[model samples]
Target chain A: MTTPTSRPDPRPAVTMSVGRDKHSHYSYRDFFRFNREQGTIIDWNNTQNLLLSEDFIVGLQTGLEREVGDASAAVMYTIGIDWGKRDAAHFSQWYEREYGVGVKQSNLLFLLETWWWPFTAQGWGKWEVETESKQKGFLFINLFDSMVARTLGDVGKPVCHLYAGLFAGFFTTMTSKELSCIEIQCYAMGETYCKFLLGGQERIDAANFWISEGASAREIARRLHQE
Target chain B: MNSMFAELLQNAEGRYLHPDELESLRAYVEGIPKRVRIYQVLHSKESVLLDRVMEKFQPTLPHLTRRHGILAWERCRRDLGMVWRYCCMAMLLNDEDYLRDKLLYWLETILKSFKMRDECRPAYKLMLDSLASIFTAEESEIIRPYLLLAKTMLVG
Candidate 1:
């Protein structure tokens, strides 16, 4: 009989290391800092901080309602679209600096997430973006824990118009094509998460009409799918 | 690595320093023990420190979120985490030029894009409070100057 012999394990054991060799994972922390003495917030590159309060955000919404009435949503949406354009420009520069590659050269999902990281850090909720229909000039976004609607409770109607406008604006800038968005579902409507559909003006208009006729989100999705 | 560091620093000044000058500065900061100690403590306590800081901000998060939106508050939380990490690395390098470069580069971009200066105060105070609660007197003494330096640069 052949004698059996034990062999040393060939696989390397996994161990965490704290050493100079490992590159520190870059995070939002790498980008900014705050000073208490001067009551200022500055980025790591030493620029002044621009900040706002929750009161300002809500007040913007309410103040618009008082001034422009029903036209407020359109104004907010228009503002978001413009903001998105500026953000795209800023993001292009920032991304190039941080990663040594232009934003245009990055992978789509990576680019979107990187673009949204600041908003997330700035106190928007976490989100998931669906670009499955990007080639068709449309996309879907689901936002969990939406700040705008989180405290608004179940008012039974979509209450995240600002986010909808933001998506519409940001995407329009990113794609260099006019896109609009509508919140088909919202946390204020007693949903677990808010859902938004963004596409060209024609598609959004159809969705809006269907929505006015009381179409369910699923029905709207199916209808938009056919379009 | 040396070239990259020099390039980043030069980018900050908008002009390149002489190669010899960059090398001298790099060599000077190479392995100071106090710097290493600060890095070790910061890295070791990072998660614990973050949790404490978050707890300190807990009561205010709802108010902040209600006003700014969840997206903004989320960003604020994340930025606080990053601030701690940056402070640690900045302290370890002990290179003022490097710190200034990183500060100017990041701040310029953030400030240009978003109006978020007001959010910094609470976060800074909470971070200092968290650090005080955790660090021993000797440890705090060693790390305090570096922390303050980072805070000043950030504010400046």
Candidate 2:
């Protein structure tokens, strides 16, 4: 497995003051107070509560670490010759040694760009079946569609809008590599915004669009460039 | 899980209800002379005990007819201030329509009561939070917007 020369600290090292944005809708103190008051809603069995209170925090910490380790493994598996298997143990050890402090699942986000590469390979795109199925199978399609309209600009192609919302929803639920299949499908559908936003105009297949789907990939690329 | 439950039971160190108490509850369930006083006493002193019993009994509750369950749930919802028990009852009944209507009704009552008595603001907030947690996403879509508006007014 290929190893990085150095690992950056995963936690934010520099302390920054919280500042209210000009359009700040809620105050931080009020949010905390709301959460505190909300705590009374659950009738905690006192003894179980006390035991679990500490355990929950520690479990969260460990879960995060495992998630990051998994993400990094995906990255190494993407780049290394044998898909990062032969040196898996050593790579994991190195990651733990280098980034042991406050390393958690949220840190998996740091390895996304690296892990996302192998997902682009031809046969690796089927993993997104669940996300696609969730979108197509659900009856409340408009709820998500409207959310996309509000978040992304309303460019108004139904398929493109659906894909955008699907991307955001999958981002909430899946890992980066798992989401890559949806990204590939969007490319197949000739979604220009999807290509620009997700594929970064690099490493996108220019010939795959017309291979089976409605529009040619080159045709979509040409249209985007023209615009 | 049983060990955990047993440990909680030991630690709470609450009073164990006599055989008479179970008989009284059974009588109440069986539609004998209404014993509001006995229930009130049980609720006031043994609320935790009631909660444990409700948790243990929930799985078996689904087999009961909807009419019977709803009647029992209505009494529990009205007489006992146990939000979790009410939620569990609604879930066990497994009728989404009934669950939504009853939960919303209870929430509206709590909200109205809070409005009538300003001192109940904290309790009202807790009730709303509990309602939000218990209700399904579809149910929440109906209740949440109004609840949020009320919360905003209260916070302000």
Candidate 3:
């Protein structure tokens, strides 16, 4: 989990030749304002039990318990921030401080890039990372329909729903012990969450769930039940 | 005349007849002059052309002689390329198990026939690409292992 001083290139090296949609540009600030107006932020924060409600947490805990069996404790953390040039770097720093124990440099960097920018900006992508430890444990996960608004150039209430469901799924499954810290980098309108995990059996298990064939949010829950 | 015809038909019934038998049959039928009667006789029976070819070039497993089976298989493949291509297309469209099996059988035959020929490379590539495109995510999972085998054979 020792954070590297130099940041790796966040973008894919190969250039894709797909054409972009010609329409209006949706800023992060606009997205955030719309979410606030629709009470998405409140629901996300659980201010009045509207967002990130107790029930969601219970369901998540239930799933985790099924997967890991009896756990000593479980906790959930929310991270958010505004748009800035140094946001990614700052997030990386916080992640290292939170989850740096026994995490490999390559895996940490790959996780940061995959979660922070690609998943946040592009809507969907997959990441696979292996620890540098003697056992070389690995983690894999994919985000789907997360960047629909950005990629498809359309935004409204539907985008918020997709984002909330995906992030909520992530938040519910991950534990404080499994993750060192949660970082939220804010933009003009919206924010991205980056979760860092301290290498543990649970984290590896979660990673396996992510890459397993035919895995989805529902499938992961079924797997947790079977376990 | 009926007995003569019966003798001729009985003579050609089974076994690999000489190539001259085919030519003589055609000539004898043409001499009948009555087109409808000739059509009735020929249409009533299956053409033994395929059987004759099969008899001439016996296809054996493990391909006893390298040149014999391989060369015969090549001729059959070239003759049946159109049929194989159609089978490949059908498999892509319907995703039928039987069609896919047939396509693979033909591909293997072609590959074995032209072991190191240039045609093998493109044919294998086309088959792989078609499989990748045609199969759904779930079906692809089942088909991927075979695809990998074909890929290794093409490469090695």
Most accurate candidate by TM-score: 1
Top candidate when judged by DockQ against the true structure? 2
Count of clashes, each model: 40, 2, 12
lDDT of each: 0.66, 0.32, 0.34
lDDT of 1 by residue, B1-156 (tens): 233465557675966677886687666457467668767877898878778877777676567677656686566667666666656666666554444444433442343234344556566666776677787776666556655665554543
Better of 2 and 3 by lDDT: 3
Pick the winner on TM-score between candidates 1 and 2. Answer: 1
Which of the two candidates, 2 or 3, achieves a greater DockQ against the reference?
Answer: 2
Which portions of model 1 show Cα errors greater than 4 Å? Answer: A1-31, A43-53, B1-156
Off by over 4 Å in 3: A1-145, A152-227, B1-156
lDDT of 2 by residue, B78-137 (tens): 433433333333333322333333333333333332232243344335545554345445
Error of 3 at B25 (Å): 39
Which model is ahead, 1 or 2, in terms of DockQ? 2
**Model 2 alpha-carbon miss at residue A30, Å:** 5.8
Better candidate by lDDT, 1 or 3: 1
True contacts kept of 1: 0.00
Please provide TM-scores, in order, for all candidate models, with all chains considered together: 0.52, 0.21, 0.18
- Weakest lDDT window of 10 consecutive positions for candidate 1 chain B: B104-113
Q: In model 1, how large is the Cα lDDT of residue B39?
A: 77
